[model samples]
Target: MNAAEIARDVSARRVSAAEVTAATLARVQAVDGDVGAYLTLLGEIARSSAARVDERIAAGEHLALAGVPIALKDNMCLEGARTTCASKILEHWIAPYTATAVARLLEAGAIPIGKANCDEFAMGSSCENSALGVTRNPYDLARVPGGSSGGSAAAVAAGEAAIGLGSDTGGSIREPAAFCNLVGFKPTYGRVSRYGLIAFASSLDQIGPLARSVEDAALAYDIMAGYDPMDATSLDRPVERTADSLRADLAGLRVGIVREFDTKALGERSDALYREAYRDLERLGAELVDVSLPTADYGLATYYLIAPAECSSNLARFDGVRYGLRVEGADVRAMYDNTRAAGFGPEVKRRILIGTHALSSGYYDAYYVRAQKARTLIARDFERAFAQCDLIACPAASCPAFVFAAKSDPYSMYLMDYYTIPMSLAGLPALSVPCGWTVPEGGNLPLPIGLQLCAPLFGEKLLLGAAAAYERATNHALAHPAQIGTVPA
Candidate 1:
């Protein structure tokens, strides 16, 4: 069920919050063994939290997300709760303070059932990089749920959580959501505070919601998003008000299709899905226009350089002397080397080395600085496109979820996020909504497809409205995976 439906039922006394929470915990217990979706399941705490929300509702208090059960990505801080980012490095760690987003959700009466798994430090595109183990896709257990927000999307897809909080740097949230057939919304960069989120690529990261439905995603977005005094990059404008202000009518909405996105780069199956999605949109009374963002050709290369460069600096803090895993040596330097070598997974170490090399003094201007300039030009390309159109529509990824074992080369795996990453660099509001599914013969691969919608910065309302309309037309969110529902959870 969606958050709004749960809230309505809870408020109407149709069900107790404790019951829902218990069922969710039960679901997690049943499926998480195979999925690896959650890092820490806070059973008693979640039940207690739900009971309190029920108490508040019985006491005649009004709350937006009352009795809605949600999960947190392991990367986001929760006071006194373990926040590991699915890394062994922080196996013994717990946050002394809660993130502003988590605090807001708690205040709005949302129940956090557990901490979801993620790629260590949110570095990899697939959850396979997580120190915790790969988060299997709900649709097909043999395949991976795309990451680093893979666990959050997987939990929601498996109906273990009504909503989940995930941090998107590059395509973490959106790609996973697409793989799992859920709605993933990433607001304009800085629209949500990054203060307590374990930084990945600092500038590109933003906390957003994953839900089974578009409206549910928007509702959660409204609650957790806003300016916070603690974050330097936080925008002062109100995200809730901006989202609420979105128009429902599509009559004058200009939807741009980046002609470049529909190509061989997306592969045959994915390109066909995009074409089908556009045809469906055309039938929905929306006008489609072709547009170009030529510089987007290098989005993958640019993102790899910029995100890792930033992550290299941000992650330098966890070198044995800081909050993460510590190894002892005769001196601090050896301790640092030992700790990192042992603590970091292969993927994290690879990115760090690549980032360090890119940012080194002699190479900075050529690789790092040039990438930033290219990023600026790409942003401008979007600006030029937006001037001619109110929104842009495309596929969320080049392909649907691939077999987990099939991914070998790091660069090839990274190419999956190519379509979605450019928007992150531009700091625009982008959402991935399920378009349909492809039932491939002889492969048990009933993969989900996502249609991506992007709008100007802080234009969530427009994107949400479009997504909501498309959702109604398609009814994809209401569809559930076979044998997965409120069976136990």
Candidate 2:
């Protein structure tokens, strides 16, 4: 069941929260071994939380997400749960407090089933970077389910959870959603509080949701987004009810099509899928208008500099003096070096080196400062484009999910986020919905393709509503992986 149905059924006393929780847990236990979506399962906490929901239901309280089982990306702190971010550096580190987003989920009566695995410190484009384990795509175990929110997306796609909360910085959530054939929403920066979220790139990281349908994503977003005094970057604006804004008609909405996106950069099949998406939107009453975002071409370059620099600064706190793994050495400097070398994965180390160098004395202006300027240009481009259209349409990625190790080089893997990083750079709201499916050569199962719809800052209601319209017109959201109902023997 979707979160809405679960909440309604639980509130109407048709099914107890405990029963729903048990079923969800059973589903995970039966299939998680093959999917490897979770690093830890909060079975006891889930049951206790479900009991609380039942009690609230009995008292006539209408919780928004009553009894809905959800999975949290390991990067978000849930007090007493191990928030490892799928990195060995903090493998056993337990969070001392819950993230503001998570606190909201609990208040709305959503049960967290476990900490979903992710790329170590949310650094890579594939779950292969995870020190914990590789999370296989449900559609094809040999292929990747995108990253750093791959596990969260996979859990939702495989029906292990009703919804999954993920953090997006440079397409972490959206790319994974595209790969897993699920709906992923990334709110404008500061729209959601980041108080207890483990920082990857502080400015770029935003908490969002991955779900089987657009409405489910919107429902979760509504409950999680709002002003939080605890998070200084949190927007002070009034919270909007996105779920109520869902509509099945586009009518006069003008959707912008990025001219750069229609070029030969995408694969033949992917380009065909993108064209089909344009037709699908037009059929649903949307007016497609050509638009240009010249600066978007530099998004990947700009993000690499800014994100790594921020990550280098934020991750500095994990030094041996504070918490996490600590290795002994001859002196303090040696100890710090030894601990970091042993704790961080290859990708994390590479980024740290690049970031530290970029922020170093002589190169700051050449790298970091220049990147910030490019970021502003990207934002300005969006502002201008939004004036011409209500939302922008593009492919979620250049291609569909690739087989594991398809991108052995880091640079090639970075290009996987080409279609997604621009919006993150602009701090805008973007949603990825399953538009269609494509079967790769020699591949038996069809892989899902995602269509990304982006809106200007604070335009989530419009963004989600349009996605809902497309979803209603074409029931692509109803498609699920063949492995969703089965466990590998």
Candidate 3:
């Protein structure tokens, strides 16, 4: 069952939170070995939390997420869980407090199943950067589930969790959701609080959900989107309930198809799939129009600079004197150097180096300031595009779930987020909904592909409304493609 149904049934006493938690735990145990979606299991905490939820229900309290199981991307802290961001830096460090988002989930009666694995420090495009364990795509174990939210996506797709929390810093959430055949939603910047989420990039990182459906994603977003004094970046505005208010169709709405984002360049299959997705929108009453984001090509370069610079600044807190893994040195300076070198993965080191150099005195304005200027331009491009169209549609990524080790070179891997970074830079609400499947020439299993949809700032209401309409109309994820080789695609 999805989160909404689970909550309904549990709240009505048709099922107990304990039962749901138990089954979820069982499923995690049954499949997690092969899938490796969870870095640390919270079965004990989940059972206790479930019991409390059931007691609350017995006392005549209705909970928004009664008995619903969730997987948290390891970066978000949960008191009892080791909130490792799949990095050795905090490998076994227990969280001192529950994240505001997580605390809210508990209050709503959601069960914390486990902390899902991710790229170390949430830094890589694929889960391969993880120091703890690798999370494979549920559909095909040989393929990646996309990163750094791969574990969260894999957990949801593998049925280990009803919904998974993922942090999006330039499509970490959406890409994985696309690869895993789930719906991933990244709220507009500050729409969701960042409290207790280990910072990746302060400006770019936003915590959202990777769910099985748009309704579920909206449900989670509705619950999580609000002000938190704990997070200065959190918006102070009141959030409307999006789950109930989803529009039936895209009547009187305008959806933009970007002029520069050519899906045809991705190849015949990917191009055809996204084209059908656009047609699906048109069929749902959306007026498809042409729009252009002229600065979009610079999104990746801008993100690499800005995100890493922020990462470099934010990560400075992990000195040898403080928490997490630390190696001893002759003196304080040497200790700091030793700890970082031993703790961080190669990918993290690479970003730190890039970021440090960008932020350094000599190159500060030349690179960092220039990137911020470029970022503003990207946002403006979106603003111009939005003036012409209510929303913009594009491919979530250049391709679907690729085989492990497919992108060995850093530059090639950086290209993975080419389609996703611009929306993030604009700080706009966006989502990737499953649209179709593709079986690469040598691949036996059909990999999932996503159609990315973006909305104006704080325009989540319209964003999700149109997405729900299109999702219902297409249900592309539900049907598999025709047989490509030996098995039905």
Candidate 4:
């Protein structure tokens, strides 16, 4: 069941919250071995949380999530639970407080099943960069579940949890959602609080959910979106209730097809599939119009610079003087160097080096400041595009979930977020919803393709309504893996 169904069943007293959580945990035990979706399982805490929900329901209290099981990306704090961010340096760091988003979900009676695996400090395009373990696509064990939210997507796709809370910097959430055939929603920047979430790129990081259905993603988004005094970056504006406002049709709304993001460039199959998806949307009452983001091609270069510079600054706090892994050295300076060298992965080190160079004495203005200017122009591009359209539609990823070790270099890997980075740079709300299936060459099982729908800042209601309309017209998310997901059929 999706989050809404589980919540309905549990709240109606037809099934207990404890039963739902237990079944979810059991599924994890049976299936996670092959998928490696979880970095840490919270069985005791999950059961306790579910029992509290049951008691509240018995007391006649209404909960939005009401016993729905969730998988938390390891980067989000859960207070006392290990929040590793899939990195070795902080592999055993127990969070001192819960992330506001996680707290909100729990307040709504959502039970956390485990801490999902991710790329080291949410850095990689694929889960391969995780130092501890690898996460496989539930559809094909030999393939990858997209990252840095790979584990979260894997958990949801494998039925171990109803919703997977993931943090998106570039395309962490959406790319993985595309790979795993789930709906991953990245709310507008500041729509959700950043407090208690370990920073990656402070400017671009946004928390959202990966779910099997659009309604479920909207439900989670509504419960988690709001102002937070704890997070200075949190948006103080009134939050719209998107789940309740989801429309059955996209009447009177214009959906933009990015001129720069043409589907034909992705190949004939992708072109045909996405054209069909757009047609499905048009049939559901949306007006399709052409829109262009001239700076879309520059998003990748701008993102790498800005995100890495921010990462370099944020990660400076992880010196040996603080909590987590400590590799002893002859002196204080040596200790810092020793600890970081031992803890951080290859991808993390590469980004840090690039970021440090970008911020260095002779080059700060040359790279860092220039990237900031480019980001402003990118934002302007989106602003102008929104004037012509309500929501933008494009491919979620360049391709379907590829086999493990497919990308040979970092450049090849970085290209995975080609379609997702611009929105992240602009801080707009975007989501990837399953649109169709594709059979890879020599592969029998079909992999999913996603149609990335983006909206102007705080346009959650309009964006979700259109996506929900498209989703209802095409129930692509309902499709399951033929005969895989860590267990025998």
Candidate 5:
């Protein structure tokens, strides 16, 4: 069931929260071995939380998420649970407090089933970078689920949870959602609080949701968004309920087609799917307008420089002195060096080195400073595009889920975000929803393709409404992986 259905059924007393929670946990236990979506399972806490929801329902108090089971990316802290960000550096570290977003979910009666696995410190395109384990795609176990929020997307796609929280820096949430056949949302930069979420590129990272349906994603986003005094970057504006704004008709809505993106660059199947999605939108009464984001061509380059630079600064806190892994050495300098070398994975190390070099004295102006200017240009491009349309639509990724080990080089893997990083650079709200499925040349099973809709800053309601309308018309969100039925009853 989706979050809305679960909440209604639980509140109506047709099914108890405890029963739902147990069924969710049982589903995880039965299939997680093959899926590897979680870093930590909070079975006891989930049951206890569900019981509280049932008690509230009995007391005639309505809860938005009532008994819906959810999964959080490991980077978000939940007091008393290990928040590793899927890195060995903080493998044994337990969070002292819950993230504001997570706290809000719990208050709304959503049960957190576990901390979902992710790329180490949310750094990789594939979950293989996780020190904990690789999260396989439910559609094809031999293929990747996409990353750093791959686990969160996989859990929702596999029906292990009703909804899942994911952090998007440069397509972390959307790429995974595209790969796993789920809806992923990335709100405007300051729309959601970052407090208690372990930083990974402070400027670029935004917490969002991955769910099987648009309404579920909207529900999760509504509960998690709003100002938090604890997070200085949090927006002070009044929270808008995206779920309530969902509309079935798209009349008068002008959707922009990005002229900057080359359809020839996308796989044949993916390109075909996106074109069909465009036609579908036109049929639904959305006017299609051509738009261009010239600076978007430099998005990947800009994101790499800016994100890594921020990551280098944020991750500095994990040094041997304060907490996390501490390796003994002859002196303090050696200790710091050794500890980091041992704790960080290969991908993390590469990014740190690249970031440090880019921020170094002589190279700062050449790389880091230039990237900031490019970022401003990217933002401007979006501003101009938004003037032409209510939302901009494009393929979520250049291709669907790739088999594990398909791209061994880091640069090749980075290309996975080719269609997604521009919006992140602009700090715009974007949603990725399944548009269709594509059967690869040699692949026996069809993998999902996603259509990404980007809106102006703080325009999540408009973005979600269009997606919800598309979902209602196509019912693509209802498609599940073949493995979904394999979970034990």
Candidate 6:
């Protein structure tokens, strides 16, 4: 059952909060060994929270998300919870304060089942970079569950949690959601607070939800999203009611298809899938028009430079002098170098070095400044495109879920996110909905594909409503991963 259905069943007294929480916990225990979704399991805390929810329900008290079991991405802080970003550098660090999102969910009576694993510092596109272990795709154990929000996506797909929270700087949230055949929503930059989230690229990072359906995702978003005084970048926006916005009335919804996203940019199969998705949207009363976004052509190049430059600065705090693992050396500087060298994974080190080089005084203007200019143009492109259309439709990523070994080459891995990085640069609201799957028969691996819907800044209402409508039309939201014993039949 979806999150809405589960919450309704509990509220109507058809099921108890304890019962649902137990089922969710049991499911996580049963399938998590193979899925590798969670970095920390909060069994005792979940049960205690479930009991409180049940008590409130029994007393006829109102609760927005009472008894709903959800998983949090490791990057989000939860007071007293072991919040590791799947990095050995801070493997033993426990959060002393909770993130606004996690705190809000708890206040709404939601039970946090655990913290899901993620790429170290939420840096990689594949969970393979995690210090804990890779989070396998629910559809096929050998394939990757997209990252750096891989575990959050896998947890929702495997039914270990009703919903999960994930962060997106590039396609971290949407890519994983596409891979796992779930709904992932990335709100406009600053639409959600980043005060307690482990920083990756502070300028572009945002927190959102991943769930079985768009409505569930939106519901979670409404609860967790809002301005937090602690976060300087957070926007002071009121929480708009999204559950009531899910309607199938797309009478004048103008949808644009970026001409830049041609077959040449994406491979043959991906292009075909996108064409089919456009047709599907057209059938749903959306007018699909070709729009030019020249800046999108340089999305990858700009992202690589900007993201790493920011990462290098943000990561300078971890010097083995304070929190997490430390190594003694000949001196303080040597100690800092030795600790970082030993603690960070290879991929993390690579990005840090790239960022450091880009930010160096002599090279800053050539790399960082150029990337920033490109980013400005990219954002302006979206602004121009939005004036021509109410929404934009495209493939969520360049391709479907790839094989475990397919992304061993860094360039190939980087290219996989080509279609996704643009929206992040623009800092707009985007949603990824499961369109269909590739390798549909004869093999255990079913490659899930997603159709992305993007809207102008702070236009989540339009983006999420469109996704929910598409979801209801195709019944993709009801589809669960096969072979996962925890998934509902």
User: For model 2, what is the error of residue 417's alpha carbon versus the real structure, in angstroms, after optimal superposition?
Assistant: 0.6
CA shift at 169, candidate 6, in angstroms? 0.6
The list of candidate 2 runs beyond 4 A from truth reads 484-489
Best by lDDT: 4
Please, what is the whole-model Cα lDDT of each candidate in the order they appear?
0.84, 0.90, 0.91, 0.92, 0.90, 0.86
Flag regions of model 4 displaced more than 4 Å: 480-482, 485-489
- What lDDT score goes with residue 130 in model 5? 94
Candidate 4 lDDT tens digits, 1-489: 889988998899999999999899988888888889999999999999999999999999999999999999999999989999899999989999999999999999999999999999999888999998999998888899999999999999898899999999999999999999889999999999989899989999999999988899999999999999999999999998999878899888889999998788888888899999999888888899999899999999999999999999999998977879999999999999999999999999999999999999999999999999999999999999999899999999999999888896999999999999999999999999999988888787888999999999999988887888888889986666534543221
Report the lDDT tens digits of candidate 1 across residue range 1-489. 778888788878788888888888888888888877888888888988988999999998888888888989999999889888888888779998999988998888899998998888887777888887668888888788898899898888887888989999888889999888989999999988888998988889999999988878888888778889999899998655533544444666778999787655666766677777776666677788888999998888999999989989988988887696898888888899899888888888888988999999899999999999999999999999998888899988767787775678998888888878989999999999998777644456578878889999888888898887777777765565632433232
Q: Which ten-residue region of model 1 has the weakest summed lDDT?
A: 480-489
- The clash numbers for all candidates, in the given order, read 1, 0, 0, 0, 0, 0
Give the local distance difference test score of model 3. 0.91
Which of the predicted structures, 1 or 4, would earn the higher lDDT when compared with the native? 4
Question: Model 5, range 1-489, lDDT digits (tens) per residue?
Answer: 788999889989999999999999988988899998998999989999999999999999989999999999999999999889888889999999999999999999999999999999999888989998888999888889998899998888787998999999999999999998889999999888999999989998999999888999999899989999999999999978899899897999999999989776786777778898999999999999999999998999999999899888888887888768999899998999999999999999888889999999999999999999999999999999989999999988878899888888998999999889999999999989999988887788888889999999989999999999998999775555455464332
Model 3 per-residue lDDT tens digits across residues 227-267: 99999999998787889878789989999999999988999
lDDT of 3 at 424: 94
Instruction: Please report the TM-score between candidate 5 and the true structure.
Output: 0.98
TM-score of each: 0.96, 0.98, 0.98, 0.98, 0.98, 0.97
C-alpha RMSD values across all candidates: 1.8, 1.7, 2.6, 1.5, 1.2, 1.7
Q: Look at candidate 6 and give me any clashing residue pairs.
A: none
* Shift in Å, residue 7, candidate 2: 0.8
In candidate 5, residue 77 scores what lDDT?
96
